[model samples]
Structure formats: C-alpha cells, structure tokens
Target: MRQMHGAWPKDALPHRIWDESYMELQHATRQHEFVTSLYVQAKLNTRALLDQVIPAYEGVFSDLYSATSLQVLRAVCKDKWMRRRL
Candidate 1:
C-alpha cells in the first residue's frame, strides 16, 4: 500500500488528465444542448404569441418564421407605423 501510494503521484498525472478532458467535453456538450433547447423554446414561444396576435399570417406564409415572412411583417409594421404617425 505504501509503495503504491508513493508511486501514485507519478501515475496519477497522465491517467487523470484524460478524465478531466473528457469531463470538460461533456460539460461543453451539455452547455450546447441547453443553449439549443433555449433557442427552440424561444421559437415555439414566438410562434405561440404570433398565433394569438396574427393567426391569419400562418395561412398567408407557408412558414410564418421565414426570412420573407419577417421582411413582409417588417414592411407592414413600418407602413402601419407611418400611417399612424400621419
């Protein structure tokens, strides 16, 4: 036991390094998953809010969250704001 304990310092370094690296990779993977989930949840919440606010938009745009849809929405909102100001 004493001999093994004495050799532990020499043996532990290389052996333990990989375990730390693997743990760090796992932590990074978990963080990425958490961030992706939050993004998906935000998209779902946005869709739900849009359903209540502009349910007709879904019928008009095949994908309500597409680039073209967003651009059209921006243009419409700008037009509305301009009209309101006038």
Candidate 2:
C-alpha cells in the first residue's frame, strides 16, 4: 500500500499537465475569437456610416479603407472647412 501510494503522484503528473495546458489553450482561443468578432463589427459599422454619408465614395476609391483614400478625404474636408471660414 505504501509503494502504490508513492507511485500515484508520478502517474498523475502527466494528466495534470495536460489538463492545465488544455485550459490555457481554451482561454487563448476564446480571447482570439472575441477580438475577431469585435473587428468585424467595427468594419460593418464603418461601412454603414460611410454609405450613408457618401453614397458615391466607392465609385472614387477602389479600397475605401486605404490610407491614401482616407488622406484625400481629410484634405478635401479641410479645404471645405477652410473655405467656409473664409
């Protein structure tokens, strides 16, 4: 009985390691999925707002989210605002 009890911890070590590793993996996977969903939702909301604000935006820029397109939009808005002030 003493020998069996001493060997039990050795036998259980691998199982304990596997269980903890699996739980860690599950936590990481859930965090990744949550972040991905948030990104998708943000993209959808941006598209919806752009469509309402500038119906012809897509006709001008092949990639609406491109840096160049965004810069041009900022410049144009700034020009308009400046003209209004003048």
Candidate 3:
C-alpha cells in the first residue's frame, strides 16, 4: 500500500498491526459462521458456535488465501452452540 501512497510512517506501524489482526479475527469468525450457515441450508438441525472461538484460529495472513493461507476454521459450538452440533 505504501508503494503508491508514498511510504508508511513508523508511528502508524502499531495501528496497522492492530487493524490487520482485527480484520483477520473477524474473517475467521465469519468463515466459521458461513460453513455452519451452509450446513443449516442442508437442514442438519445442528448447533455449534464455532463463530466465537475464544483462543481464536491461527494461520497465515495473506492477501490471497489460496496462495499462502494455512488456516482452517474449526467448527466447535460450545456453550449454547453445543446443543446444535450435528
């Protein structure tokens, strides 16, 4: 981004890092939900809250998931979501 925007400053580094993490976590959570939602379309009557992973999923951060992504969303519904596990 800096190449065209002229150079990212040192002071913006921390914010940039935080922003990256926030988006990553959000996406993982979303992916988990997406799968379950699709499963719901199949009418399995399952229950799982894999969307709320406490420890958070860990994997490669990349602009292209197919290229460098090593992460996999593990659907595990605990608490209220446990009742719907299929």
Candidate 4:
C-alpha cells in the first residue's frame, strides 16, 4: 500500500488544480461545447446520460454543491445511474 506521506499533495492542490482546469476548460469553450453537444446530438444512450453526466459534471459541481449543501445532487446522480441501468 502506498504510504500516506509519500508524494501526497497538499490539501489545497486538489481545489487548486480543479479551479485551474475549470478555467482552462472555460477558455476552451468550444471543446467543452463539442463534448456536451455530442452527448446531446447523438441522443446518447439514455443510460449514458444517467451514468455519465454526473462524472462529466463532476469537474464543476463542487461550487454549486457547497452553496446548496443539499442532498438533491446525490439524488439526481443516483437517478442518472438508475436510468442508465433501466
């Protein structure tokens, strides 16, 4: 098992990296749009939306999640997973 101390980044690193990448994605708005549009345009497998949308949104959900401090997110995510399975 990897030692807890080995190369583990500081706590801030995750938030920092997340913020930077979000900014980068925002900058490359076209790529972001393409990925999203592709998902929609193809009428992706309903299961795809239910299983994958949260992960695709994972990169940006934290901010709004923090503000809301609600379980709706979990429910919504679970619904997606359920739809995918059904």
Q: Order the candidates by TM-score, highest first.
A: 1, 2, 3, 4
Q: Which portions of model 4 show Cα errors greater than 4 Å?
A: 1-63, 66-70
Q: Which stretches of candidate 3 lie over 4 Å from their true place?
A: 1-18, 44-86
Q: Give the clash count for each candidate.
A: 0, 0, 4, 2
CA lDDT, every model vs. true structure: 0.83, 0.82, 0.47, 0.60
- Residue 4, model 2: lDDT of 50
What are the clashing pairs of model 4?
A: 47-84, 50-80
Could you say which candidate leads in TM-score? Answer: 1
Local error of candidate 3 at 72, Å? 31
**Candidate 1, pairs of clashing residues:** none
Model 2: per-residue Cα lDDT over 1-86, one tens digit each: 23455547534553444577899999999999999999999989977887887888878989877999889879978998999999
How far is 25's C-alpha from truth in model 3 (Å)? Answer: 0.5
- Specify the highest-lDDT model's number: 1
**C-alpha RMSD between model 3 and the true structure:** 19.1
Stretch of 10 with least lDDT, candidate 2: 1-10
CA lDDT for candidate 2: 0.82
- lDDT preference between candidates 1 and 4, better one: 1
